[model samples]
Target: MNRFAALEAFVRVAETQSFSEAARRLRSSKSAISRNVSALESELGARLLNRTTRSLNLTEAGRAYFERVSRILADLDDADRALGQLQASPRGRLQVSAPMSFGFLHLAPAMPEFLARFPEVDVDLSLNDRFVDVVDEGFDVALRIGALPDSSLMARRIAPIRRTLCASPDYFRRRGTPQTPEDLKAHECLRNSNVARTQEWRFVDENGKPSLVAVSGRVSANNGDALRIFALSGFGVASLPTFIVGADLRSGALVSALDRFVPQDLAMNAVYPHSRHLSPKVRAFVDFLVARFGKRYWDPDDGRP
Candidate 1:
C-alpha cells in the first residue's frame, strides 16, 4: 500500500463521485481502486465517503484534503512545463573565448552581423592567448588557432592558420634576406614566448620532407600581435601567424624568410563541451560561425580533411 497511491485513489473517487467511474478513468480494476480507498481511510481513521445505496458522496474532511492535494500536483506539473520551454528556446547569454589578435581583427568584426541575425542572444566575449578551461570558465565555445593538444573537448575546424618568419622591407633592405635557415642567426629576430623549443623551428616542405632550424631573436613577446608590431617597426624578424602578416606579404610590407622552414599551417577550431544536451544558443552560434567564416581562406596550403 503505497501512501501516495492510496491518496491518489481517494482523490480520484472523491472527484468522480463514483468508484466505478474512478476505476474506469484510472484504468484499474474497480476492486483494486476500492481496496486502495479502504487502505487510505483506515490509515486516516476517518470515513471519507458516504456510500449510499443510490448515490456516492464525499465526507467534509475528504473534500478539504482533495482541494489541497490537487492544487499541489497541478503546480508541480506547471513548473516542469515552464522549464521545458526554456530549454528549447535560444534566448540567453552566450560566452565565447578567443585569442586576442584574432578576436580584435576577425571575430569582433563578424559579431555585429551575428547579433543582427540572432538579436535575442547576448554575446559575452573574452580574449587571450592562454588555453582556457571552457567548463570551469563557463564559456559556451572557444575559438582556438594552431595545433590543439589532445583533450576531451569537442572541436569543429573553422579555418587554417600558418606560422611564418617575416621581416619588413626596410629591415630586409638594411640587413639583407636570409635565403637559408642557418643564415637567420646573422639577423636580429623577434620571438614568441610560447615557442615549443628555443632556437629550434620545424617545417614540412611542399613535398612533405621535414626539417628543423635553430633560430635566435633579439626581442621576444608573449603576444603574437606585439611580435607583429615589432616586425613592422623593423625591431627584428618575427615568427608570426599568416593572418597577422598575410596582407603585408602581398602588399610587400613584409617578406617571408627561409621559406624552406616554418611550421605547417593548421586548421583553426571552435571547441566546446561534449554532453547529453546542447542548449539552443550554443548550436545557433556554431552554425553562425560556419556560415559566416567558412571560406576557402581557411585551408590555403595542402588541402586535406
Candidate 2:
C-alpha cells in the first residue's frame, strides 16, 4: 500500500471522526478507508484510533501524527498551487535561441515592446549563426528560416523572408548592369560562405522556370552583414535577405538587380519542442512575434527595381 495514501486516509478518518464520512469525502468505500487505516497501523506497528459502537476517536499517537503530517500536506498543497500559478502566468525566464543576423536585426529591436506587454516575463535570448539543440541546450523556443525537416518539434510561420540580389549604384555603374541571368557570369559576386553552394545563385526566370548561375568574386565571408557591407562599398553584387538590405535599398544606398527573377520567399518560423501544453511565456512571445510582424515589416512596399 502507498504510505502517503495510507497516511492521508488515517488523517481524513481522524479529522472526520467517522470512517463512512471520510470515505464519502475521498469518494471511496468505507471498507477501503478502514483497510487503509488498518494498513497504516500495521505498517507503523501502532493503533491510531479507538472505535466504539456509535463513535470513533483518535488515540494519543494518532493525534500527534495527524498534527505534523497535516501541516506537511498543507505545505505540499501550497507548493503545488504556487507552481500552477507560475504556469498560468508568464512570470519566469524565457530562454530563446535564434540566428545571429535575424536576432540582432529584428528580434533585438522588438524586445522592448514584448517586455512592456509581458512585464512579468524575463527573456534570456541567445543568438548564434550555428544550429542548436534546443532541448539539449535548455532553450524554450527557437527561431528558424525556411522549411523545417521532419521532426517531433512544432513550428509556426511568423513571417516571410525574401532574398534580394543587390549591389551599390557605383558598382553597377562601374561593372554595368546585367539584363539577363547569364550576364552575371561577367560580374563579380560577393558570396556568403554559409550557403551550401556559395558559388551558385538560384532564381526564377521570366518564363517562371527555375534557373541557377555559378558566381565567384574576390571576397567571401560567412556573415551576411559582411557580404552586405562589401556589396555596399561597390565591391561586388551580393544576394542578401530583405531584412538586412531593405533599408539600404530604400535609402538608395543599395540598388536591387534582376527584380524579375526574384525567387520564392522563405518562411520565418518559431519552433518549439511540443505543440501541446505550451508555457504561457513561450505562447505570449510567439503571439507577440506574429502580431508584431503581421505584415512584412522590412518590405513595407513591394520591392521593385
| Every model's TM-score | 0.66, 0.71
Best by lDDT: 2
Model 2 CA lDDT for position 287: 94
C-alpha positional error of residue 60 in candidate 1 after TM-score superposition, expressed in Å = 57
Cα deviation in Å at residue 264, candidate 2? 2.3
Model 1 lDDT per residue over 1-305, tens place? 88867777777787677788879988988998999999988988888888988987877887777667655554554566555744676668999999998888778988998888778889999998888987545688999877788886788888666777888989999999887766777888776776567566666666767777667777777888888888888878887777787777777777778665665667679998764355578777888787776773522243423
Q: Model 1 misses residue 292 by how many Å?
A: 2.7
Worst-scoring 10-residue span by lDDT in model 2: 296-305
Residue 100, candidate 1: alpha-carbon lDDT: 91
* Model 1 error, position 19 (Å): 51
Give the per-residue Cα lDDT of candidate 1 at 116. Answer: 83
